[model samples]
Target: MGDENRTGMTEFYFRPFSSLPKVQLLIFLILLLMYMVSVCGNGTIVLIVCTDCSLHTPMYFFLANLAAMEICYSTIIAPLTLANLTSLRKATISLAGCGIQMFFFIFLGGAGCVLLAFMAYDRYVAICHPLRYTIIMSWTVCVSIVAASLALGFLVSLNMTILIFHLPFCGTNEIYHFFCDIPAILHLLACSNTHAHQVALYICSVINVAIPFLLICFSYAFIVVTILRISSGAGWHRTFSTCSSHLMVVALMYGCSSFIYLRPSSSYSPEQGRVVSVVYTFVTPVLNPLIYSMRNKELKDALSRALGRKVLHQSK
Candidate 1:
């Protein structure tokens, strides 16, 4: 009986839009389409960048990495979310499964934050100091930056996951949000002293989200000043075009993420949190490829040429 009770307590139930049974099918279909588009779009970006010799630069290299990260991030959460949405009864996950989800969610999220900052810095160098751009952002330096971002992301996420999951969950196994996240898990589920865990999460949020966001802001500040000094209108337009897509992505990602993570645990609203998670995890990935491809002529041309080559080969 004791073993049975312990096993029961270790399972978590997810309440995914439980009240909206009338529209559950619509919601599921929409999310499915979004997930498919997100995968295909990010995959195309990675493929185009890898195959096109002309796109073998620091900028496209980082873009491809970001695409891959989005694929992993979305895959970690989307299928589970869809499953829960489609179930007539409440959906449940094992404690171990929840831990895995939380770990990768934080991991990819932190990597993306740092990667965006690096991309901003890349743009700043290319536009602000055109002559020294190649020397400053060489292949070795770019690789090092990507490596550092991944290392930082995994280390921070690992630490947080260990701290949070080490707590005892004695009762109440229902998690209010769609997937297991740090905030929901710490605030709503844990049955022990979470004061220390809350403090640690706040610090992690500062390091992972606040610091990188500020760096991106500072880079753009300098970039704007440099562009203003370029006398020609065409130079101004060209410089703005290069940075616009990245800026849009940064705004969408950081805005949704900050709202979810950068608040006191007491202030967490499960409904609002789930809605924002959908935007950042599902919607943003689909939009990222469109933002980059639609705004940039170079990527469009590369994609067209790559597709055209495939068509010619298939016809032969």
Candidate 2:
């Protein structure tokens, strides 16, 4: 009995549908609504960016890119989470399924971090050195920065997933979070993974959270300095408005990410981690388009034009 209890079965069983209660339908409906809003909001941002030629500037270019990334980022886990919530039959993901989800999650998320850092730098260049902005943010430089961000994201995610999944999950395989996260996955490992795993987690922290954070902080610091240097009060106000939306986004992403990943696992409960993950994973995506695009005068104009065109077509 002791041996059997100590050594969990390789093929884990999930709870049956019959065992679950009826109120889970309410939870499913709420999750579905959240997923729909996230998808629609990000989708609208992509459409608005592509359609508006006036928004072809570097800031809008990166904004579109960020919107695309948000779409991918939310897709990585929202559907699965909603499905799991609704199924009544709380199914268990195979090890391979979990790994694939983990890969996409980290890939898009890490890339977004790097991309946000690049965007901050872009904003800094635009505001701080407006006269030389064109020369500084050349086509080649922009492409290279974006490419580098994507490549770095893929490389880091690949390595982290490989390292994490290679660990033998010989124990009970119930992931606490709605998705596969590093610390949550670590909690289910049968064997002791003390020093080496901690090192890997630390490295992930530096790459995913710390380094990007420092870059964002430094860029914002420069931006604030540059804003203060502007001679006209109107100029200062305009520049500050241009960045406030992005500042809000950076604060949300970094604040949640820092709390979720940077802390010692012992300090928090898995339940708390799940709730925090929702902020960045679901809420951020839903809020981003509303925050960034809705605040912009050009986007509102384009949206109005698009709506008018649709109305005319219907009349025709």
Candidate 3:
């Protein structure tokens, strides 16, 4: 505790991934490949959404933003992690650095949750109320929704970061995981009693994860009802197809995050935490582009057109 008084700063060093000592190199290589692919894939999605005239619609617009978020969120964690892996995980981050990382990560994550719900609502409007979809989801409205999602994300993230970092963090000075996750920081690094903070964090998790998930479910229920009402089987298949990718993403994200955060802090095993963090943090981002592109015909078509234009121009 005197370390803070002496230096006027608190620094948290990352404890090595002790659970897997033998395979850090292999893990590094795999993560590097996955990170590269994720960046490229999501970058392509963003570029396509921006340049392709055919993709200038509400759904694609939301998808572009989602891709951008994945890129940023993953970048914030992956590069530093990869660098630390090279050193076998003796990474030190200052208090301010930790807070900034947490804030942006939570900001992007919170916004993403809300954005997914909005995408569901978008689909609901398109299918359930096609006649008014244009009026309801106009360009101005879409921009406002994005703005609001970001604003809410910013405020919530700011609040959580403030709540956690406001207290004096003293103890082992070692975070067991790669990044300063809320639970890891709260449980492992905090010097004082954090029961109140834990409770507040849990409530925030419910609001961030549960409410949006419920909204998605509600939107889908209407979408399903509307789909079933369609007289033709093809219509049923077509409508459902549009939602499958988003559902997969929702399942992957909500499932992994809920498993980590929504549970009691008593069960926070450093080993388990790191592994699960790998899933939601690294694995999900890499899969997102593949999920959306492989499932959606429009994205693939736009990609092909872009590639063809590049090849032809190069040949010239």
lDDT of 1 by residue, 181-295 (tens): 8877877877778999989988888888899899999999999899889999999888888999999999999888889888777888888887888899889999999999999
What's the ranking of the predictions by lDDT, best on top? 1, 3, 2
User: Which runs in model 2 stand beyond 4 Å of their true positions?
Assistant: 1-23
lDDT of each: 0.89, 0.78, 0.88
lDDT, model 1: 0.89
Error of 1 at 117 (Å): 0.4
Best by lDDT: 1
Candidate 1 or 2, higher TM-score?
1
Report the lDDT tens digits of candidate 3 across residue range 175-235: 8889879988887777778999999888888888989999999999988888878999889
For residue 70, give model 2's deviation from the true position in Å: 1.1
Deviation of model 2 at 273, angstroms: 0.7
How close is every model to the real structure, measured as TM-score? 0.95, 0.91, 0.95
Separate clash counts for every candidate: 0, 0, 0
Model 1 weakest lDDT span, ten residues long: 1-10
Residue 72, candidate 2: C-alpha displacement in angstroms: 1.2
Point out the worst 10-residue segment of candidate 3 by lDDT.
1-10
